[model samples]
Target: MSSPPLPLPHLALIGAGITSLTLSLRLTSLGIPHTIYEQSPSLTELGAGLGFGPNAARALEYIDPRLVEIFNQTATFVGTPSPQGKELLLQEGKAGDDKIWIEFLDGTKQPEEGEELKPEFVIRAGNNKGHAAVHRGAWLDVLGGLVDTRERVRFGKRVVDVVLPAGSKGRVKILLADGTEAEADGVVGCDGVKSKVRQVLMEALGEGREKGKCGYSGKYAYRCLVPWGKAVEAVGEDRAGVSSLWMGPNRHLLTFPVDKQDEKFLNLVAFVTDESQVWPERGPASLTLPATKADALGDFEQAGFSDSVLQLLKVTNEKMDKWGLYDVADRPLSKFYSGRIMVIGDAAHASTPHHGSGAGFCMEDIAVLGALFEEAIARQRLTVDALEDVFAAFDNQRRERDQWLVNSSRRAADLYQWRIPEFLKPNSLEKMKADIEQRQEFCWGFNVGAAVREAKKHMSERLAAYK
Candidate 1:
């Protein structure tokens, strides 16, 4: 066969997070030219754990099967019957063994002495029964290792501004914090929630800088990676090994295991909502404010959490840091792209962790963008207009689904914390169960392949208009 067309429109990827790395892998597979710009001095990601639903896993497979393989190699699959299967076999839980996504319990009540606590409801695992999870740093290292090289990823080059092309034929200019400039045919903002490229894109779209800022969801969490042995010692192995959620009034705690080559740990996030308190500005001190172990115990104690749950919290650091959850719900962008600059991943639609699907959604974004760029190369449309068409098509096909995640995530927070008004009515348990089941199915049942085909069709129509 003849050689494939050379990749068109040299691209600049802002931020070297998962979004950038995943997209880099896809572009590399297609021989596209691109660079990852990160503000950090090195490739290090700080977070406790990252979880992926089946939909997210499918997105990885769609981008490249190797991605799924890499993920499976490093991730911990909780309560999965078969780790390497394509079909999810739904089965009821058995004593000492649970086969479910999460067992939701009433955190506000403690079981009577000698009484076994029963789950209010359970959400069966989606496809493959693989609730794949891993430490943020571990997976970041793996992904970064695959894509990061001195020539491909540039560090300490924080983006200060993105100057959009004045005409369809000109290049987009990127200004860095170190007083340097780089030009590319297009810029994809894969930066996190505090993305400067997003700010620049917002201003270019005539939306004020405030439009790009992430808003606090009135929730804060205490995150820790406790040793798996310690968790098993505190709670029995059966309970500790399985993923679960303890739901209470205005608070909820989630736990899952993350196993790597060297160690296995339990990832825990205890969320509390205090609308009365105003979120402090972003800074080291504000982001991870110190709190005594007593403070953590106090928060869960009043909620009537069992000794097993409290012991898990106690196994954490004597002094815990409170991490406020923030998202783009308050000021969602009217448009995802302005000229040749488009925002993707968290930079586009950061959401609360209530849904635990943010990272998966990022992969989905990469899959769609990858398909569009492949189409662009095949068509040999190398002009700025063609790139614009690609961005427009991406925005048209992706904006609705992504923005819905942000909204639904907030709604899920309410449901988990018993803050929804419907919880006060009769049959509240039934309503909550139905809502959770429906949402989980919807989130995990997305069709990434169909999305790719539709987006390609849309991009082709847009490209034909320019012709």
Candidate 2:
């Protein structure tokens, strides 16, 4: 007799952000049927600068190698450092010599690079390699286009509730805002930090509400896009590519380029401490500061920030468009899965942007989830019990990596928050150079693809044993 037909996996993904979009594409490639319910009526590009690291770039490659090529065509790589470009400042070593260095807490050293490495206050700056800064919108457009409309990515369908049915092999039901409901073999919540599915899981598990909280990062950010011509007139045309980071007491400023076809826009971001933990509910046009331009600029002016950085803030015509920066911690969740429901991306862990790894982490989630599902289907083990096992394994594999990234990102923030102090700071520029050199491996050495493959191997063994 002929073998029974293989069961098809039906996935319901909530939210249509980059994480959801990438997951949709991966599901399609694996031939796993799925549907997406995006709350937004239409996908619009939001946010400012996005720094895609090598790991994130690799994830993009897995989805579509052409994405990398398309990104490179419009984006310029930051290479050499210029006076008009971005700068990193360091102080002289304890030896009181003309050279400066970065002293690590672990007793490592990094030397200064160029003539800017003066003894009094050294500035050893170089271009950030293997990293590309692009407009948020441009990146979204590439990922969004990957979604096949025929695959059923429904827009304007807000997920109101997730109903977990009792008993084995029962389907999970997703209630929508339009008084409609859809049942699926499984549901993936990529709905971001404020995830309704997460709420349901927490309540069902008796975890109680307010158990996990998301708060502002004690920082307010001012972001704007300035025309290249306007920026050049202020900072000089030669300073276009470098991502300048200016550090001061309790505040910082970052500027980078976002290239389009014929025009290049300068993305400027300034962060300062705010007493309130709530983010701005409006945009830049609604922000009103009692402080003058000088006060708002603060110590950034003393750090020799470019005129263009100051100009962008001054020229902003509206305050409502300005947004505040907020972040969530690595909160303990009761679980990542319940019955036929699971969560991924920011819905699982919403971290601070200090390390620029939010998008990277989310992409990693998609890769891991996709790999597990692929193996289950290949083995003809696509039942509710099999999926639950997959979810458990996926979470176990990801927990450590996510926590490490979160801690590392927080440490990076502390390092960049202050200038080199006398006596306590590095003694020589060569010594400072050595300190930074030691950290190179740790910063760029992550391999998400390898981790995913390994996790799948381990998980497949566990699933077989359980069977």
Candidate 3:
């Protein structure tokens, strides 16, 4: 039997970051026409390296097998090389669940005492190789190239609002910052963490305009790269290539290599979690400001961080980027879509980098949404009412897991700091491994194929209601 035609020939996509570009692949593949409206003057990503595991790797492969090839050839650097898939999963998390080598710095005991600082005990690690770490911009570039989305992507169209268009039954109107507007049969917002599209969706749900605004996660990151030779010089030839984590009372530093020559350097993010540390960008705006190496070194001193880790820090690239981290958990939401507008990626759920799965989850969102859209276009059931069903399916399938990411990431931060209810015994090596394995299952074991199939099954039932 011939499939139903898509209800509309043209669709609107807001924000052309990684999520939008990835989604564009699916839409383009199914012959579903979409135009990406990006607020940025150009399509690029600014950040340090990111990891993607099997679940997200499979989703990218599903998006387009070539994307994986491109990512592997260009972006897969550092971390373990999985037989099937791998990606960076988190910065650092859990009390007894750390993936990299743990080193106890000066005065491993609590900070309240005036005792002399010295190393107490350390758990020998650095053998676990279990994901891919790619520079953020290089990874985005690979995705952008493989997805073939540039032609349809329109940059500099800042989205101000997304709402149901007047007199355009079930269609959506995207208000631009320049005061012009564009209407489409439906809007798929692959926007970002501070998404205007999400606000619109929340507003429609009567959750108030500011109901689920993004907020700081009480963590800021100082990230930089170290030239490969210099890093190898400091950390030794063998240790420099793997994941190395240095831990202290309240701060930790992670080091990993970047295989791609584009960033052929050692990528490390030094995270400081001091109660007294206030965000310099105290407004609603989140800043990824330029950080001096001196400022980062000061943070190390403030945290009373050890010199063992400082050796790796001193050899880093001249550039550093500091930013306050935010997540969607603060301003909780009850739903994922409204009317013809559906939010995906950071637009819908922004989790902390503690999990390293935010973008992976975004890929999962694209996998489900794209599958349903493919089915809709094939079944000739694409329509206003039908899209609502699709959006509902997306929400039903994705909300719980995606929201879990937000909470889990926050929980991970506590676990990593040993601030949780559970206590780590003396030299708890096996216990740490066990805790890490238990907590990591959800991330590493998530089957994108199974998710796509299940969403399609649920979507089939929902589409019947509209018919």
Compared with the true structure, all predictions reach lDDT values of 0.80, 0.61, 0.70
| Candidate 1 structure quality by residue, lDDT tens digits, 246-281 | 998788999988886779888889998866656776
For candidate 2, report its TM-score: 0.79
The deviation in Å at residue 244 for candidate 2 is: 1.4
Output the worst ten-in-a-row residue range by lDDT, candidate 3: 89-98
Q: How many pairs of residues in model 2 come into backbone collision?
A: 36
lDDT of 3 by residue, 328-423 (tens): 887866888876788889889988876667898998899888888777765677766577778888999999989988988877765555555454
Better of 2 and 3 by TM-score: 3
For each candidate in turn, give its C-alpha RMSD to the true structure in angstroms.
3.5, 7.9, 5.5
Regions of candidate 1 where Cα sits further than 4 Å from its true position: 1-7, 84-98, 126-129, 282-286
Candidates' TM-scores? 0.93, 0.79, 0.86
Q: Candidate 3 regions off by >4 Å? A: 1-9, 77-129, 147-150, 166-170, 282-285, 317-319, 424-430
**Whole-model lDDT, candidate 1?**
0.80
Error of 2 at 18 (Å): 0.3
